[model samples]
Target: MYPNDGFRELERAECLRLLAKVPVGRIVHTRQALPAVVPLNFRLDDDGSVVVRISARSELVRAIDGSVVAFEADEIDAGAQSGWSVVVTGAAAVVTDPAACERLARTGPQSWAPSPQEVFVRIRPELVTGRQLVGGRTLYGVDLPS
Candidate 1:
Protein backbone atom coordinates (compact mmCIF):
# COMPACT_ATOMS: atom_id res chain seq x y z
CA MET A 1 0.00 0.00 0.00
CA TYR A 2 1.05 3.58 -0.59
CA PRO A 3 2.04 5.93 2.20
CA ASN A 4 -0.96 6.90 4.27
CA ASP A 5 -1.95 10.52 3.76
CA GLY A 6 -4.40 12.19 6.07
CA PHE A 7 -6.70 13.10 3.22
CA ARG A 8 -9.55 10.73 2.63
CA GLU A 9 -12.93 10.57 0.99
CA LEU A 10 -15.84 10.16 3.40
CA GLU A 11 -18.55 7.64 2.84
CA ARG A 12 -22.13 8.75 2.34
CA ALA A 13 -23.14 7.74 5.87
CA GLU A 14 -20.23 9.64 7.35
CA CYS A 15 -20.95 12.64 5.18
CA LEU A 16 -24.52 12.80 6.35
CA ARG A 17 -23.38 12.39 9.93
CA LEU A 18 -21.13 15.39 9.58
CA LEU A 19 -23.89 17.43 8.01
CA ALA A 20 -26.12 16.66 10.97
CA LYS A 21 -23.62 18.24 13.30
CA VAL A 22 -23.33 21.49 11.39
CA PRO A 23 -25.96 24.19 11.79
CA VAL A 24 -24.93 26.50 8.99
CA GLY A 25 -24.26 25.89 5.29
CA ARG A 26 -24.16 27.70 1.98
CA ILE A 27 -26.91 27.17 -0.51
CA VAL A 28 -25.90 27.61 -4.13
CA HIS A 29 -28.63 28.38 -6.59
CA THR A 30 -29.36 30.30 -9.77
CA ARG A 31 -30.67 33.81 -9.45
CA GLN A 32 -31.54 35.83 -12.52
CA ALA A 33 -29.48 33.39 -14.63
CA LEU A 34 -26.45 33.88 -12.41
CA PRO A 35 -25.06 31.72 -9.66
CA ALA A 36 -25.77 32.85 -6.13
CA VAL A 37 -24.61 31.53 -2.79
CA VAL A 38 -26.40 32.26 0.44
CA PRO A 39 -25.32 31.30 3.92
CA LEU A 40 -28.07 30.06 6.18
CA ASN A 41 -28.84 27.79 9.07
CA PHE A 42 -30.18 24.37 8.22
CA ARG A 43 -31.50 21.18 9.78
CA LEU A 44 -31.15 17.60 8.62
CA ASP A 45 -34.20 15.44 8.37
CA ASP A 46 -34.24 11.81 9.35
CA ASP A 47 -34.46 10.80 5.71
CA GLY A 48 -31.31 12.81 4.84
CA SER A 49 -33.11 15.82 3.47
CA VAL A 50 -31.99 19.38 4.27
CA VAL A 51 -34.37 21.98 5.64
CA VAL A 52 -33.98 25.73 5.89
CA ARG A 53 -36.13 28.66 6.84
CA ILE A 54 -36.42 31.82 4.78
CA SER A 55 -38.39 35.00 4.85
CA ALA A 56 -41.42 35.21 2.64
CA ARG A 57 -39.98 38.21 0.83
CA SER A 58 -36.45 36.88 0.50
CA GLU A 59 -35.10 36.36 -3.00
CA LEU A 60 -34.14 32.79 -2.18
CA VAL A 61 -37.79 31.92 -1.82
CA ARG A 62 -38.36 32.34 -5.53
CA ALA A 63 -34.89 31.41 -6.71
CA ILE A 64 -34.73 28.04 -4.99
CA ASP A 65 -38.30 26.92 -5.21
CA GLY A 66 -38.65 23.90 -7.42
CA SER A 67 -35.05 24.24 -8.55
CA VAL A 68 -31.93 22.14 -8.51
CA VAL A 69 -29.29 23.48 -6.14
CA ALA A 70 -26.12 22.68 -4.25
CA PHE A 71 -25.70 22.93 -0.49
CA GLU A 72 -22.38 22.76 1.33
CA ALA A 73 -21.21 22.71 4.93
CA ASP A 74 -17.80 22.33 6.49
CA GLU A 75 -15.84 22.50 9.71
CA ILE A 76 -12.17 23.25 10.01
CA ASP A 77 -9.56 23.51 12.72
CA ALA A 78 -6.93 25.90 11.39
CA GLY A 79 -4.64 25.22 14.32
CA ALA A 80 -4.62 21.52 13.58
CA GLN A 81 -4.84 21.95 9.81
CA SER A 82 -7.60 19.38 9.65
CA GLY A 83 -11.14 19.78 8.40
CA TRP A 84 -14.00 18.18 6.59
CA SER A 85 -16.41 19.43 3.93
CA VAL A 86 -19.68 18.01 2.72
CA VAL A 87 -21.59 18.93 -0.42
CA VAL A 88 -25.14 18.02 -1.29
CA THR A 89 -26.79 18.40 -4.64
CA GLY A 90 -30.53 18.17 -4.85
CA ALA A 91 -33.82 19.67 -5.91
CA ALA A 92 -35.33 22.33 -3.68
CA ALA A 93 -38.98 22.69 -3.04
CA VAL A 94 -41.01 25.15 -1.04
CA VAL A 95 -43.18 23.62 1.63
CA THR A 96 -46.73 24.42 0.75
CA ASP A 97 -48.46 21.91 2.93
CA PRO A 98 -49.72 23.64 6.01
CA ALA A 99 -49.26 20.67 8.31
CA ALA A 100 -45.81 19.90 7.03
CA CYS A 101 -44.84 23.56 7.21
CA GLU A 102 -45.99 23.75 10.77
CA ARG A 103 -43.92 20.72 11.69
CA LEU A 104 -40.89 22.16 10.00
CA ALA A 105 -41.35 25.52 11.64
CA ARG A 106 -41.19 23.84 14.98
CA THR A 107 -38.24 21.58 14.21
CA GLY A 108 -36.17 23.34 11.54
CA PRO A 109 -33.20 25.60 12.09
CA GLN A 110 -33.67 28.96 13.74
CA SER A 111 -32.22 31.75 11.66
CA TRP A 112 -29.91 34.29 13.24
CA ALA A 113 -30.93 37.01 10.85
CA PRO A 114 -33.47 39.54 12.12
CA SER A 115 -35.92 38.85 9.37
CA PRO A 116 -38.93 36.73 10.26
CA GLN A 117 -38.49 33.51 8.31
CA GLU A 118 -41.85 31.99 7.53
CA VAL A 119 -41.06 29.89 4.53
CA PHE A 120 -39.57 26.43 4.89
CA VAL A 121 -37.59 25.01 2.01
CA ARG A 122 -36.65 21.37 1.74
CA ILE A 123 -33.79 20.03 -0.39
CA ARG A 124 -33.99 16.36 -1.24
CA PRO A 125 -30.43 15.34 -1.83
CA GLU A 126 -29.67 13.43 -4.99
CA LEU A 127 -25.95 13.26 -4.48
CA VAL A 128 -23.84 13.58 -1.37
CA THR A 129 -20.06 13.63 -1.15
CA GLY A 130 -17.45 14.65 1.39
CA ARG A 131 -13.73 14.65 2.16
CA GLN A 132 -11.62 15.12 5.24
CA LEU A 133 -8.00 15.87 6.00
CA VAL A 134 -6.40 14.30 9.00
CA GLY A 135 -2.91 15.08 10.26
CA GLY A 136 -2.20 16.80 6.93
CA ARG A 137 -2.49 13.53 5.02
CA THR A 138 -5.08 11.67 2.97
CA LEU A 139 -5.07 8.24 4.59
CA TYR A 140 -7.44 6.86 7.12
CA GLY A 141 -7.03 3.41 8.68
CA VAL A 142 -5.74 1.22 5.88
CA ASP A 143 -2.89 -1.04 6.98
CA LEU A 144 0.15 -0.94 4.71
CA PRO A 145 2.66 -3.73 4.25
CA SER A 146 6.22 -2.87 5.07
Candidate 2:
Protein backbone atom coordinates (compact mmCIF):
# COMPACT_ATOMS: atom_id res chain seq x y z
CA MET A 1 0.00 0.00 0.00
CA TYR A 2 1.12 3.59 -0.62
CA PRO A 3 2.45 5.31 2.45
CA ASN A 4 0.00 7.41 4.37
CA ASP A 5 2.68 9.62 5.89
CA GLY A 6 3.86 11.41 2.72
CA PHE A 7 6.19 11.20 -0.22
CA ARG A 8 9.93 11.45 0.25
CA GLU A 9 11.37 14.91 -0.26
CA LEU A 10 14.08 14.39 -2.81
CA GLU A 11 17.31 16.32 -2.61
CA ARG A 12 18.57 18.52 -5.43
CA ALA A 13 20.81 15.83 -6.85
CA GLU A 14 18.05 13.27 -6.58
CA CYS A 15 15.57 15.62 -8.19
CA LEU A 16 17.94 16.28 -11.07
CA ARG A 17 18.44 12.57 -11.48
CA LEU A 18 14.70 12.08 -11.81
CA LEU A 19 14.42 14.99 -14.24
CA ALA A 20 17.17 13.54 -16.36
CA LYS A 21 15.29 10.29 -16.79
CA VAL A 22 12.00 11.98 -17.63
CA PRO A 23 11.90 13.49 -21.12
CA VAL A 24 8.58 15.26 -21.07
CA GLY A 25 7.00 17.64 -18.55
CA ARG A 26 3.89 19.76 -18.33
CA ILE A 27 4.75 23.43 -18.68
CA VAL A 28 2.09 25.58 -16.98
CA HIS A 29 1.75 29.27 -17.58
CA THR A 30 -0.94 31.85 -16.93
CA ARG A 31 -2.97 32.55 -20.05
CA GLN A 32 -5.30 35.42 -19.23
CA ALA A 33 -8.25 33.43 -17.83
CA LEU A 34 -6.36 30.75 -16.00
CA PRO A 35 -3.39 28.40 -16.33
CA ALA A 36 -2.28 26.74 -19.50
CA VAL A 37 -0.47 23.45 -19.36
CA VAL A 38 1.47 22.19 -22.31
CA PRO A 39 3.57 19.08 -22.66
CA LEU A 40 7.13 19.87 -23.63
CA ASN A 41 10.21 17.85 -24.27
CA PHE A 42 12.98 19.20 -22.08
CA ARG A 43 16.42 18.54 -20.64
CA LEU A 44 17.61 19.36 -17.17
CA ASP A 45 20.80 21.36 -16.97
CA ASP A 46 23.45 21.12 -14.29
CA ASP A 47 22.24 24.49 -12.99
CA GLY A 48 18.87 22.80 -12.19
CA SER A 49 16.79 24.37 -14.92
CA VAL A 50 14.85 22.91 -17.80
CA VAL A 51 15.89 23.81 -21.37
CA VAL A 52 13.38 23.45 -24.13
CA ARG A 53 13.48 24.42 -27.79
CA ILE A 54 10.52 25.93 -29.54
CA SER A 55 9.73 28.04 -32.55
CA ALA A 56 9.98 31.77 -32.07
CA ARG A 57 6.35 32.22 -33.11
CA SER A 58 4.86 29.43 -31.06
CA GLU A 59 2.05 30.24 -28.65
CA LEU A 60 3.89 28.76 -25.68
CA VAL A 61 6.99 30.72 -26.52
CA ARG A 62 5.05 33.96 -26.64
CA ALA A 63 3.09 33.31 -23.46
CA ILE A 64 6.00 32.23 -21.30
CA ASP A 65 8.55 34.96 -21.84
CA GLY A 66 9.15 37.15 -18.78
CA SER A 67 6.43 35.30 -16.90
CA VAL A 68 6.54 32.78 -14.10
CA VAL A 69 5.70 29.24 -15.11
CA ALA A 70 5.55 25.78 -13.67
CA PHE A 71 7.10 22.67 -15.14
CA GLU A 72 6.40 19.17 -13.89
CA ALA A 73 7.65 15.74 -14.85
CA ASP A 74 6.90 12.29 -13.53
CA GLU A 75 7.62 8.63 -14.00
CA ILE A 76 5.67 5.53 -13.02
CA ASP A 77 6.23 1.79 -13.02
CA ALA A 78 2.96 -0.04 -12.82
CA GLY A 79 4.39 -3.53 -12.54
CA ALA A 80 7.05 -2.56 -10.02
CA GLN A 81 4.84 -0.24 -8.04
CA SER A 82 7.27 2.67 -8.07
CA GLY A 83 7.01 6.23 -9.33
CA TRP A 84 8.29 9.79 -8.86
CA SER A 85 7.33 13.36 -9.74
CA VAL A 86 8.99 16.77 -9.76
CA VAL A 87 7.71 20.32 -10.06
CA VAL A 88 9.80 23.36 -10.94
CA THR A 89 8.43 26.87 -10.63
CA GLY A 90 10.41 29.64 -12.20
CA ALA A 91 10.66 32.56 -14.55
CA ALA A 92 10.84 31.79 -18.22
CA ALA A 93 12.39 33.80 -20.99
CA VAL A 94 13.33 33.55 -24.59
CA VAL A 95 16.91 32.75 -25.30
CA THR A 96 16.94 35.31 -28.09
CA ASP A 97 20.35 36.55 -27.12
CA PRO A 98 22.53 34.66 -29.56
CA ALA A 99 25.10 33.63 -27.00
CA ALA A 100 22.50 32.49 -24.52
CA CYS A 101 20.62 30.48 -27.10
CA GLU A 102 23.80 28.82 -28.29
CA ARG A 103 24.81 27.95 -24.78
CA LEU A 104 21.36 26.54 -24.03
CA ALA A 105 21.22 24.69 -27.33
CA ARG A 106 24.39 22.84 -26.48
CA THR A 107 22.48 21.05 -23.75
CA GLY A 108 20.41 19.38 -26.50
CA PRO A 109 16.83 18.97 -25.34
CA GLN A 110 14.59 17.26 -27.85
CA SER A 111 12.72 19.96 -29.74
CA TRP A 112 9.05 20.62 -28.96
CA ALA A 113 7.71 18.48 -31.76
CA PRO A 114 7.81 19.13 -35.55
CA SER A 115 11.00 20.31 -37.19
CA PRO A 116 13.22 23.37 -37.20
CA GLN A 117 12.55 24.60 -33.73
CA GLU A 118 13.75 28.20 -34.00
CA VAL A 119 13.42 29.53 -30.50
CA PHE A 120 14.61 28.36 -27.13
CA VAL A 121 12.71 28.83 -23.88
CA ARG A 122 14.71 28.45 -20.71
CA ILE A 123 13.00 27.93 -17.37
CA ARG A 124 15.28 28.91 -14.54
CA PRO A 125 13.66 27.42 -11.51
CA GLU A 126 13.14 29.74 -8.58
CA LEU A 127 11.49 27.03 -6.50
CA VAL A 128 12.09 23.38 -7.19
CA THR A 129 10.47 20.51 -5.31
CA GLY A 130 9.77 16.86 -5.82
CA ARG A 131 8.61 13.62 -4.20
CA GLN A 132 9.25 9.93 -4.55
CA LEU A 133 7.25 6.99 -3.33
CA VAL A 134 9.78 4.93 -1.42
CA GLY A 135 9.47 2.68 1.59
CA GLY A 136 6.00 4.11 2.28
CA ARG A 137 7.33 7.56 3.11
CA THR A 138 5.39 10.41 1.48
CA LEU A 139 7.72 13.36 1.72
CA TYR A 140 6.81 16.49 -0.18
CA GLY A 141 10.19 17.89 -1.25
CA VAL A 142 9.03 21.48 -1.45
CA ASP A 143 10.32 24.05 1.00
CA LEU A 144 7.13 23.35 2.93
CA PRO A 145 5.80 19.86 3.19
CA SER A 146 2.31 19.28 1.83
**Best candidate according to lDDT:** 1
> In lDDT terms, how accurate is model 1?
0.83
Which candidate's TM-score is highest? 1
> Candidate 1: which stretches are off by over 4 Å?
1-7, 113-117, 137-146
Query: RMSDs, each prediction?
Result: 5.5, 4.4
Q: In model 2, where do residues sit more than 4 Å from their true spots?
A: 1-5, 78-81, 112-117, 135-146
lDDT, candidate 2, 1-146, per-residue tens:
12233556677678878888878899988887687899888888778888888887787777899998989998866556568878888999877788777777676675646566577778997878777766433333324335
True-structure Cα RMSD, model 1? 5.5
Name the 10 consecutive residues with the lowest summed lDDT in model 2.
136-145
Query: Which residue pairs in candidate 1 have backbone atoms (N, alpha carbon, C) closer than 3 angstroms, thus clashing?
Result: 5-137, 5-138, 5-139, 6-137, 6-138, 6-139, 7-137, 7-138
Clashing residue pairs in all predictions, respectively, total 8, 5
